[model samples]
Target: MKLLTTNTLMVLLILISGYGYIASCTHDDIVPPAQANPTPVITRGENVHLPNATGVADGDTTKWKLDKAHSSVLWSTAYVGAAGLLTGRFNQFGMHDVTNAKMLKYPTPSRGQVLPDTSWAFYENDPSKIYFNGYVQMNTSNTGEPGRDSGCILGTGYYNTVKIIPGYQNLEINNLAKIKTTKVEFDPLSNDYIVTFDFIWQGSLASPLTQSIVGRLKYIPKAAVKDAVTGNVLYSVFGLQLNFQFDCRDFGVTSTSVADVIDIECNMNFNNK
Candidate 1:
């Protein structure tokens, strides 16, 4: 019952104010939990009927041109002792037809028009018909950091001299990494394709290394877009999702801080020409 001291009264008032502030906070004022990354959507071949190769010939000459705008080539590597991955991508690359001595090209659909249905043909059942020469521009390596990208091209620092392999140092060289498909086989169980190719890194310094990689090739014969009022198809879309890993040592990369294993994901889109 004794009168509270001035300091004690002030302390009590502070406590009451703190309690009132806490009581006034509602659910709306509380921060929500962080959200996990959303799963990517598969829009290339969503909900389309796959065509059968019943009448398709064994050596059909139909050509599917690559849609470079819709394609991507991403690479990642873990730091020697780090927990996360360092990812980057190539801004320039293309599929080539060595037999034709030219790069593959696709026709761009007009703003209001779409490619005809006959343009696209599926060759999954006949794997032999699926083949291409792939190339990557070494200078186009991008990691969102201009300095790091330049370092990657020069094979310096954490890149560990792996960016431009030996014998490819000539200024006149094309500065390209090439891939020539030697064989293609369809795996029914996984509904994917196993591709064996010569991954040519060094122009003449080393022999072509053979690597067998598996990739999912999704083909949608129908157009991805439709007319709002007429329901007419716009343009057909298809793509290959390829993920592979390789040791840097295999390509002469020997840095200790840089992980020996490098992962690559190439998402290639193609449109019927």
Candidate 2:
């Protein structure tokens, strides 16, 4: 994969299933919606490169602008999103359509640990304030290829952010880790940034810490199918909460320090000119 980006560097720190499936919300609460096609990786380009000097220095809240000219792809997970390298790119800007992605799990890895994860973060403006947000999905199933074919994790919600505090190497964004959604707007009314679409996140690789992983994502809301027996809508947009708790100090770890609130904002229109 290419080098990390500013936002992806921020999400440096930070799931389950089926009853197997946790039916927290019921449908029939909202009205019908329309559809519009957004930009995908395919129309984006064939490759991506990390421009020099775009990332923030320690404690710097410098904005990382999208180099629309030399830049092709938008998301940074472009490379990591896939497991094996492929011969071609897809129509959408996700991962290689046929390439296998690096599953984010390394059970009892000699060097890395994959928390029963569900949160991702990035340094806000400054390399200080980290935003953390993750909503656990109901089914811990496996989906196809993310933002591409049809799967990643076969679940209801998609949240991917894993920070290796005080990152492993001397990499500047080292101690930091993050990923960003497409550009969003600062909402004045809600007093919170709303990203209508595209959840963005990627992490410090810090070092080449590897592990075994099997997870699901993408909290896309679908029309709750009428129950086979009752013909009733079954799910709604419910606000379910999950706390990703882990004390790095307990693992004989004294390197990276957790930040305050790492808020992954949603509710913005991230496509188009």
Candidate 3:
């Protein structure tokens, strides 16, 4: 046995500490460790930075150019009478420019108050006053199963035993304009603009069906940043969320395994691009 000097013991301790740190940092399966739980730590502080101004400046007829990259549409249908649900999303779509949108104050949140008002109203005479225009290509849909996606949506072999033609190829949900909100409401705290609109769907089934539907839009505001040089701040950045339901039978989607009615939800975020 040899006695270790003080210098040698210090070197050994440093090597052990370094090795332990390296081992702790290395991942087992190339996955990082869970992050610390997020919680508000600041109660009051003078170092806090606040925006110079913040409000939805767009008036009753604010024309917004949608940010397509950040926008998306998702849909889900019952697999068998609510026993299970199959959800999918549309990869390609666009929002037609808005002409004149009605403006309403956001309802003040209170204790035991319901958040979303479900009462909806529609235009009787003219349906073009305010509407949403968008389309979904049947081929671009995804339901987590490649075989089912290609066969059911694209009419590949999986849909039918003999490989029949796809029933619905492209669905154009145009003329969603007749939908009139009973009242326009904005959430001041979250800057969420609430409106209900009627959506029209033009199906490409064997019979070429057409139907009108209603939905709700929760237009929430995204964060804004100020220019470093000019100090001009960016504002009015918003994202519109739509959730609605429609019958698949109307569009000729008569699959016993799938449900008759499908629920659609979309989110469209807009910026000053």
Candidate 4:
């Protein structure tokens, strides 16, 4: 009886070993339940490419210069005691310094492009690489009406308390530390950057109004121009258009008749000098 039990145990062991060898041989042919459909991981990073329609690379680190000739600041509010809207624009306003107005070309994948397969968080936590000091000369505002323009200028100054100071009436935007580079979206079709930054409205007697302004800065490529006589490339141009809206009450512009909300639009295109 003991001999018979021992033989039964050996037969069971041999069967188990044969099954293991068969499984190993057909490992590639069989699919496990867990691996039948695997989960996908998404990675984010700058996509570098050659100069395309925008004449810039995907991960281009080039610092673009702000073109002042093609730029302007426009704003509109409800007409004081009227039904129509009152729109005005600043004729003399630009990057605090064109020479130093630097922007990075961090291209992102969009328009049905494939996402990276690896994990990368470099841009997500990266600080702002660009700093610009933008200002609007309140005195250069034009609304077509001389009297109305003067009144609007006085009202704007009264709120900000800009005396003989020329550039004191300012619109400062410098917040490098707050920009989340990782989430910055790049539109490949039209070089537009969806960005958000701190906009410091230094006006009125109340205090400097600091608001996080979110908007898109579009880089419009213009037709290439060549020298008339030399037949050589004279210069190239691009347009930077910005549109945004905000509340006047937030900046202390409590005009008796003007509406609380204000609409702003701008266009700027210049050369790289």
- The CA lDDT of each predicted structure is 0.54, 0.24, 0.46, 0.49
**Over 4 Å off in model 1, which ranges?**
1-63, 97-122, 152-174, 203-223
- Pull out the clashing pairs in model 4: 67-270, 70-268, 70-269, 71-267, 71-268, 123-182, 124-182, 159-204, 160-204
Please give each candidate's TM-score.
Answer: 0.57, 0.19, 0.47, 0.52
Put down candidate 4 lDDT per residue, 137-245, tens digits, no spaces.
Answer: 4545678887776566323345543333342222222211111112345443444566565655544534456677766655454445778888886555555566656
For residue 129, give model 3's deviation from the true position in Å.
6.4
Best prediction by lDDT: 1
C-alpha root-mean-square deviation, each candidate: 12.9, 31.2, 16.0, 16.5
Q: Which ten residues in a row have the lowest lDDT in candidate 4?
A: 112-121
From the highest TM-score down, the ranking of the candidates is 1, 4, 3, 2
Q: How accurate is candidate 1 locally (lDDT)?
A: 0.54
Please write out the lDDT profile of model 2 over residues 173-252, one tens digit for every residue.
21222222333333334322333222221222323122221111112221233578988864322111111122222222
* Number of the predicted model whose TM-score against the real structure is largest: 1
- Candidate 3 regions with alpha-carbon error over 4 angstroms: 1-64, 97-130, 153-204, 226-236
lDDT of 4: 0.49
Model 2 reaches what TM-score against the true structure? 0.19
What candidate 2 gets wrong by more than 4 Å, as runs, is: 1-105, 108-114, 120-222, 236-273
Q: Give the TM-score of candidate 4.
A: 0.52
**Candidate 1 lDDT, tens digit per residue, 1-273?**
345687788899999999888877865498888998575332222232222232122233233455666789888888667897777887656554222232222233333112111222235567676665666655557788776665542233332223444322211123456666667776554556676666656422344344554444444343455678998865556666666666667666665656877787777666543
Give the distance in Å from residue 25's predicted Cα in candidate 2 to where it truly belongs: 60
